[model samples]
Each structure stands twice: as structure tokens, then as C-alpha cells.
Target chain A: MAKTLTQEFTKGLWEEIAPFRLVLGLCPVLGVTTTVENGIGMGLATTFVLVFSNLLVASLRNIIPSKVRIACFIIIIATFVVVTELLMQAFAYTLFLKLGVFIPLIVVNCIVLGRAEAFASKNSITLSIADGLGIGIGFTLSLAALGSLRELFGANNLTIWTTPTSVIGVQEVFGPHFQPFSFMVQAPGAFVCLGLMLCIMNLLGSK
Target chain B: MRELIKMVIVLTVLAVLSGGLLSGFRNATAARIEVQQLKFVKGPAITAILKGVSNDPIEDRFAIKDGETERKVFVGKFDDKANTVVLESFGKGYGGDIGLMVAINMEDDTIVGAAVTTHSETPGLGARAKGDPGFVSQFKSLSINDSFKVTADGGRVNAMSGATITSRAVCAAATEAGGIYQRMKPQLIEKLKEFNK
Candidate 1:
């Protein structure tokens, strides 16, 4: 059976979700998802880079030689990453500061390059855009969910963005009486949370 | 072979195009990026330390040559007099350099307040250098000549639990800020004089 264009798009959301299902871009998923806002911001930034890179790669697929394709792909992807970095610095400097090296590290994010190589390089531009959107939204939602979980359990707060008086940008998810399970915000917690989520996903997928 | 030449041409064109697009975008957004950085990341820290300043320290800033790099010094005016200036300092931390900002009351050469700006310390441990305000608040109202060391090192300041190294680094940065203020006193004072005119 021939897969339709919509399949290429929709599949990224659940079946081939980048962070959970595909496990393609787990670096930002773990690193930036400490707060819901950081996760959403990182996700959107990665999506911007992914969409443009995919579109450009697919459009230039014919002209790019097989021998130099990887090099070409890197340059294209890096260009978008820089664009994302500058835009984030200009508009979202707080998030940019919070994200730090991870923003520049997006140049090496396997998801953008993977899509360019595996999907975009061979697919049509329209299809590539759809794939980018689907995958980007999936990655974003996954990050937000993961971040919300961590923020809820780890700090007893869900910090979406800084409010005027709050200064620290956190909304108490539970009452002040709740003692935060701080471990959920650390490295081990990231692995455990992601692992548990993956297990749950597998259980659902198997059924 | 002709294939080699074709590959070279393709790569060169791609590089040039990518380079051109990036440079163009960077040039367009450079000013806005700087303003955003000052407004968001550094502004809060500056204001936090210079709590009573009437003027916008982010805007009332000047740069001076510090070694090979130009260091930006923000001026905080109280009662319309630029008698205080905030400057940044760096000290070696467990992971790397810990950046801190110290606001100095030029009159008595005392620290108004200090805040950690950046660090690469462990998140839940050493990162308290930035996260815990009480750690930095220890420097408030202290004379610049006072040794800014952790209590473990026989100084008045207390180190964060399990983050003694980071605490020491922050104290070192405050001490560095004092040194910078002393060295740059003449210039900073002169600059502040002009601001009042």
C-alpha cells in the first residue's frame, strides 16, 4: 500500500514522534524541559530551523551532488540555526539566556539533519513542509509535556513565563504545603521520566 | 574529472549563499539583539542590586577598556546623582568562570549589592550561586576593603551547602570587582562627574 502525503505528516505526531517514538532529538528534550516555557521556546526554535532546512533541502535535492550532500545539508541547516539564534536573542533574550549553549547546539540537532536527509532530500517541498510542521509540533508538545511534569513534581511550580511581581516566573502548581520532589528536575530525573514515558508509549503502541 | 569540478562549484555556491544570508540577517538584527540582552538578561540583575536607582542603568551605561576587552559599566543614579556604578567580574569556578555583578557606592567604597550573572556549575548543587539570593546578599553593604570570603575560609560570608566552591568563586568575583573599582576609580569617577553636568 502506497502511503499518502498526510501519512508522512501525521505519522510524525504519534507513530514516529521525534523525542519519544523516534528518539531523534532527546538532547533539548532533557536539557531545556525544566520549565514549560523553556520547552516550548526550544521546541518552536528547533521547528523553525527544521522547517526551513527541510524545505530548502527538498527544493535543492536535484542540484546537490550525492558526494557533497552532507556538507551541503550542514551548511543549510547551520544557516537556519544561526538565524534562529539571532532571532531568539533579539526577541526572547531571557529564554535565550536560560537556553545558553543549547541554542547553538541546535545546529547539530539530529532531527533537523535527519529530516533533511531521510525525508526532505527525497520528498517534494510541500510534503517536506508538512513533515516539518508535524514533527515540530510533536517535538514541541512532547517537550512541553515533559517539562510540565518535571516542573510540577520537581519544584511544585509550573513556570511558563515571568509574571510582573513573581520575578522568578513560576506559578505554584500545588499548595505551598507540598514539599517538592526536587530530584525530578535533575539529570537522573530526566532519564527516569523519559524512560517511563517511553514505556507507557510502548505499552499503548503494542496494544 | 568533470565531476570533481561540478562538486566544487556546487559546494562553493552553497557556502556563499548561506554565508550571505546569515551575514545579512545578523546585520539586520544586531542592534535589536543587544537591546534585548540588556533589557532581559542583564537588566534584572543590575536593577536587583541597585534597587533605589531612579535612572535606567541599562541605558545610562558606558564602556571602558579593561585589558583586551571593553567592559560595560552601568551607572545607577540615586536622587539624580550618578554616585554609584555597577560592574561585572569573573572568578574561576569548579566548572569554569563564574560571572558576577557588583554595585559599588562610590562615596564610601562599599558594595551596595552583588548578584551572580552566569555560571556553569552543577544545576542542583553549585548553581545555587545564582539561584539562592541569600548567598549573594551577604555582600550587601560590605566595605570593598573587606575580604569577601566564605565563612569556611574564616570570612563573614556563608557558603551554600554542597556548593562551597561556587560560593568561593562568587566571593572571588566580588573581590575582583573591588579590585576593578580601585583600578578604574579615576576614570569611573571622572565619567560620573560628566554625567551630572
Candidate 2:
């Protein structure tokens, strides 16, 4: 009567994307993605929170009373988010500032809560962890794919993961002196990138 | 009754755990956080100024005091050049109080570095005054006695398109800071020795 772990992992790629398919956590997906670097940072942090929270909620489902389950889920999620925020501030201060409030806002991301309510509440602990992993990876890939395209076209460079040190002798190739395109780093560019990515994703899924 | 008691106990435990975690983090990283903050605020801009110059801003401080104003303004000497001082000023812009930190030379009030630390400015346009080279570079080497104005007002700097109000506000703040420095040169010089000690 129980579903296999492989099905749990595969479901996240198309059936429940946490963004395009489930239509969850869209605010941050668009907010912090001015550049591919910020997008990837945000994506990985969010995936970490989602996986951990999902696993925690599933493990505690039976112990918590149904009447207060919603409140319990929120505390667990918030605890993990606080940990993520502290780690970013300590180790990734630059990215932490660039991503700003979106990092802390992970507590409210519907993806985590939705998983808790829909699958974690009823699924086996092992299956719940699998679901979390599948969904987290799918979300991270989607973000990186969207971010790379935005950075390449909007800024005319592939700056997703390179540090400043990597550019020591490479400035001439990137630009005479690379000027990040102001337009692409602003809010309107978010919509442009999301729309183009959405269209491509739809086309690929259909064919 | 028993369920209610358990609920209170659970909520209390959760709150304590979260608070303790936050406080522990704050204590452990306070010094490193302060150092990072100081570097982020002034390091890059000051370094950019000293790149081709002989002096470093951190080593030297400016000593200036004007007899008339009675208020002293000390410009820190770096590598023996009196070129940079921490400035405090704010303007009521279209957004809100825009507080700034500016570093300028005592001899000429030529800005060594400038940063707007607080502003609720228009996202893309007004905020560009910080990121846009055309805007930031305008303040460099500008004589304190010289007018701070947008090119439209017969100055050298261009007005940020769609952001003329914010642009003027920035210029006004810069001018005020410059005038105060000149007015208090005598007292500022004397105070630098005291403050530095």
C-alpha cells in the first residue's frame, strides 16, 4: 500500500515543482534573482530549509496533536530559518546582504508548509525524506537554470559562481571593465527572466 | 486541563530554545561582525582613492579648526596626508532622512570617499547615485569652495534621469558638509589631537 521512494523523488521534478507546478514560494524566486549569483545562493538556502523542515515535520506528525499541528509546523520551520540566516550572516555576509529579507522569509515559503500538510502528515518518514530531497533538488535546478540565462543575456557574462579572485587576469574578456547592466539587476528584469524561463519550461514539458 | 498545560509547556520550551540560540550567536561573532562592518563601510571607497597615491587613509588624520564656528572637525591623517574624515549629515529627500558618511581632504575638501548609509530612495534610479560611477566620481577632487550642483544648474555633474530631486538632495548635503568643515577648521584641528588620543 506504500509508495516507493523513487516515485517520491521523481514527483518533484514535474508534478510538484514548488514554483512553476505548485505555484509556491514565488516571491523570493523573483525578488533575489537580480544576478545568477544571488539566485543560486537563495535557491540552495531555500532547498536546505525545505528538506530539513519536511523531514522534521514528518517525524513529529504522530506526536503532535492535530488541533495545534499548524502552530507546531511553523515553529519548526522558523527555527531552521533562523539557523540559515545566522550561517549566511557569519560565512556569506556579502550574499546575505544581497539576498536581504528574502533569506529570512523562507519561514513562510508555502513549499515547506505545503509539503508538511500534504505529504509529510501522512507519509512514512523515509518516504517524506525522499520527497524533500527530490523537491529540493528540482527547485535548485530550476533556479540555476533561470539565473544563468538572466546573467548571460541581461549582463552579457556568466557570473553565477565565480569569485572576484577568478577575474584577476580575465577582465579584458569579460569587458574592458565590466559594468553590470543596471537594468538587469533591477525588479523589471526579474519579470523578463521569469517569463522567458517559464515559456521555455512549458515548451520543453509539452514536447 | 492537562492538554492546555502541555501546550503552554511546549510553547515555553520553544521560545527559550530559539532565544538562547540567537543570543549565543550574537555573543560569539560580535567582534568579527564589527570588523566586517567597518571594512564594508569604508574600506573599498578609501582604497580606491589611495590606489595611485602615496598615502593610506587609515594611517593619517586631518587636523582642521575654524575660529568662527567654534565646532571642530578633525580629518584623519592616513600615511601622513590629511585627506579623510568621517562626516555625518542627513537630508529629507523624497524618500526619508538620507544619512551619509563622507571622507574628504582637509586641505581642499576634495572627497576621498562617500557613502549613503540610510535612504529609502527610488529603487533603480535614485539608488544608482551610489552604484553609478558617473554619479559617484563627480564628488572626487571637487574643491570644497566649489559649488555642488547638477550640470543643469551650471555644475559638472549630470542629474540622474527621473531622479532630479534625489540628485539635488545629495548635492545639498555635500555642500553643507563642506561649508561646516571650512567654518570649523580651527576648532576641528585642535580637537583631532584630543579625539585621536
Candidate 3:
């Protein structure tokens, strides 16, 4: 039975939610999630790459030989990543620099590659686009949530972005006198928070 | 043989297509990207260091050929005369290269200001090099002839607490900038003539 387009789009939000249910692409989730802004920026950039690549892969699926498909997919994905990189550098230089190597690393992000191979390669172009959007948003939301949690606990405030002449985009979730845990923004804290969140998600899903 | 030939042709076509697309994008966004870099990344640091200058440094910048690379130097103008030149230098840091922008007063051969433009130092530690103005402010008014080093190395500047390595990196970058200034002094003096009122 063929799944409906809406189902394909909606499933990624929860059933196949990346970094949680799917457990795909944990690098940026842990790395960039120290701040909500970084998470959002990284997520949107990934989403752009995912949608275009998925569209291209699905439309060319029949013509792309199975033996060379992986190579072809990578080339297509790399092309989109380059375009995204240049555009971000031009328009969002601060976010671009903050994201650093992660932007270029999006080329190999398993989420993008996974969609290309598992969903896009076999699905229609329209379906693939839906899957990309669904999965990308799911990933973005997860990153933002994790980032906000970590930032709140670690730094006593949520850092949105730092600009010249002002440290803008930060909100004091905790009072000024509060001594933040601080470790929540570090590497170990990322693992602990992500692990706890995943456990909670599993507990809810099981019930 | 047929299968291999087909694969080769397919790969070659994809390469050509990707190459063309990327080059087109690079061409389209090249100028904008340069401006963006200066505006958000380097511009703030230059402006912070070159405070009180009348002309916009970003618009009044020029690149000078230095060895094999063209170094873009932002000029600060006062009363319609260029009086300062800001250049970037890099030093190896904890994670990677730390980029430092050093502004020089052409009139007195002293540093107007210095700031860290980019660094990959650890957050709350070495990263303070970029955030802590006090750490960089020590560079102000220092003679270009002075060896820019942190106090740990018997120099006037103090290292950011718990970030000595990063502190040293910034100093190293400033030292290099001083060297570049010495080498380019004559060119900079001649270049300033263009902006003279």
C-alpha cells in the first residue's frame, strides 16, 4: 500500500524524528545545540541542502545507475552545500562563522545522505520534498530545544547571538544572582541531556 | 566495458554540471560575501580599534600586494587625511588559527588598538580573547617597535586568566602585524597620499 503524501511529511516529525527516534546526525545536534540560534541556523542550512538534494535525487533516480548512485548523490549534495555555504557567507556571515566547519560538514550529514538513499531514491519528487521538510524541521526543533535547555542550565541565560557593541539575543531565564550549573553547555552535559531526552521520549512513546 | 564507459560518462557529466553551478554561485556572491565579511566580521573590530575616525573604514579599504598574497588594509581617515592602517595577522591557537586585527597610527608609529577578529579558543577560557576588551586594550598606545608579548614572556600585556595560550597567540599575531607594518611602512605612507585632502 502506498503511503499518502501527508503521512510521509508528518511521520518525520515524530515517528522518524531524527536525533531522537531515528538517532541520525548527532554531531551537529550535540555541537551546535549550545545555543538556540546556532541550532536554528544549522538546522535551516541543513534543511535547505536536504530539500534540494532530495528533489534532485528522486527526479534522477531512474536514470542514475544503482552502482554509481551513491557517487552521483554525493556530487549533487555537495553542489547544494556549496551554494548554501556561499549564500550564507554573503548574507549571514556571523551565523556562518559561528557554525564554522559544521556548514561544510553538512555534505556528509547522515540525515541528508540517509534521506537520499532510503526515502528519496525510491519515492516521488514531491514525496521526497515532504520528507526533507518534515525531517529537517524535526531535526531543527530538537536542536533548538536541546540548545535552549543546555543554555538555560549551563549559563543561567539563553544566548541567541552576540553582536558588536551589545551582547544581544540573550535572555535571563534565571535571575542575575543564580549560579548556573555551567556544565550543561559542555560536552558531557550534551550527552547527559540528550540521553535523558531520548529516554523520556521513549517512555512516552512506549505508553 | 559498456557498463564502465556509461559510469564514466555519467560521473563526468555530473562533475561538469556541479563545477559550472558552483562557479556561477561563487561569481554571483563573491562581492557581496566580501562586503559581508568586512561588515560583520572584520568591520566591527576595525571600527572598535579605529574609533573617532571620520571616514568609513570599510569603504576606504585597499589591498596591498604582500609577497604572494594581497593583504586588505582598512584606512582610518581624520580631517580628510588617512592616519591609520589596520591589518590582520594570525597565530596558532588551541583549536586553530587566531585572527587578530592590529591598527597602527601612521603618524606616531604606535598601536591605536588591537582586537581579536576570530579565534577557536575554548568557551569561557581562551574565547575571552575575543570578548574581553580589557585583554586587548593593553595594546593601545604601545610603540610598534615593542615586542608584543604577554607578561608571562616579560612583555607589558597581561594574558587572560586561564587562557595564557590564547593570550600568547594574540600577542604573536600582533608581533607579526608589527613586522608587516615595518615592511610596508613606505608603501602605506605613499598610499596615504591618495586620501590626502
TM-scores of the candidates in the order shown: 0.74, 0.65, 0.76
- Tens digits of per-residue lDDT, candidate 1, B111-188, equal 999888767888779888787888888898899866688898998898899988998999899888888888788899
The prediction achieving the highest TM-score against the true structure is 3
Arrange candidates by lDDT, highest first: which order? 3, 1, 2
Worst 10 residues of 3 chain A by lDDT: A161-170
Write the residue-wise lDDT of candidate 2 on A150-190 in tens digits: 56556766555644345211222356566666666567877
lDDT of 3 by residue, A1-207 (tens): 599888988888899999999899999999988888899889999999999999999998988888999999999999999999999988888888888879988999999999999999999999999999999989988998899899888887776666545666667776788888878989999999999999999998999
Q: Taking the candidates in order, what DockQ does each have? A: 0.68, 0.22, 0.66
Model 3 lDDT per residue over B80-142, tens place: 778989999999898789999998989999999998987778878998889889998998999
In terms of lDDT, model 1 sits at 0.88
Off by over 4 Å in 1: A163-170, B48-56, B62-73, B77-81, B84-191
**Residue A188 error, candidate 1, Å:** 1.8
Q: Comparing only chain A of model 3 with the true chain A, what is the TM-score?
A: 0.95
- Evaluate all candidate structures by whole-model CA lDDT and list the values in order: 0.88, 0.69, 0.89
